[model samples]
Target: MVEPVDPLQRLPFGARGPLLDHLSRLRHDLGKYVSLQVRWLGASPPPEALRQAMMADLLETHRGPGGGIDAPTVWAGLRPALVGEVPLDDTITVDLSGDVDFERLDDAMARISGVVRDLRGGVDGPQTVATGIEAARTVSDACRALWSRLRGG
Candidate 1:
């Protein structure tokens, strides 16, 4: 078994609490983001194929075989590290095992953040859409610790 790295060791010190706290919150809020995303996809009644594709991607990306380091996985990792209890069965199962690359997840998260920011910036969108995007951003922000710790930034 690959030994888990001590996330705190990566930090410079003094920032551990805030960083860990952020990751913990991110893990908590990720659920809200998923719920909002699902609701937004359904609200417009978009084409069945498109919706299915999106959800399929989400499932594969977040819970499928290879830990893609999406919000959920990142969130899951933090709890066990912090509480000293490894999660044997996630709320959603992951089929592959390995260290997650934070960079890719970081980029994907940035894109999502941008979209959410636009909604909040008054980009002339429907209230529902704006609300959903805002919710997603709010949830994503909760993971700042997860990102920082993972990225060793």
Candidate 2:
């Protein structure tokens, strides 16, 4: 993973606690989005189709192109990395692995967008780093595409 532009590890303990706590929560929140994405798509999803919101830090580890990170694969990676076993499976399943397409995709993304917006709104103060902001924005923008065009946020 790229070291954050700021040397976060060097901060003094008292000053660091809040930032560390936020970062940890940030990780779980991002992971939750991916897990929801996987279950929404089914047991297997075409990562390429959902590639627009790829997590920059996970791209190399997932071994997919930067633009095509496999979200289902990343979801597996997120499970072990969760802090204190936070559950990320509370998502509505849309099942696009069969005949359904855009309608299911749009519905899934619209629901996903709400979670993404909540995640974005929760980020503040020390948690508003570029990586966090960009990740949230990427997913929010991606999820907004269909529903925003069809209706609104």
For all predicted structures, in order, the TM-scores are 0.30, 0.24
Clashing pairs in 1: 26-142
Evaluated with lDDT, which candidate comes out highest?
1
Clashes of each: 1, 0
What's model 2's lDDT at 108? 41
Candidate 1 on 1-153: residue-level lDDT in tens?
Answer: 977754345443354555445455555545344444455565556555434433333333255465433443444544453333442233311111222433333444454444444534654245434443444444454344445555464
Per TM-score, the best of the predicted structures is 1
Candidate 2 residues 1-153, lDDT tens each? 854332222333343334334334433444345434423444444554334233232232234355444333443343232222432233211211221222333344344344434434653232323233234344434333322332321
Cα lDDT listed for each candidate: 0.43, 0.35
Q: Which ranges of candidate 2 are over 4 A from the true structure?
A: 1-6, 39-153
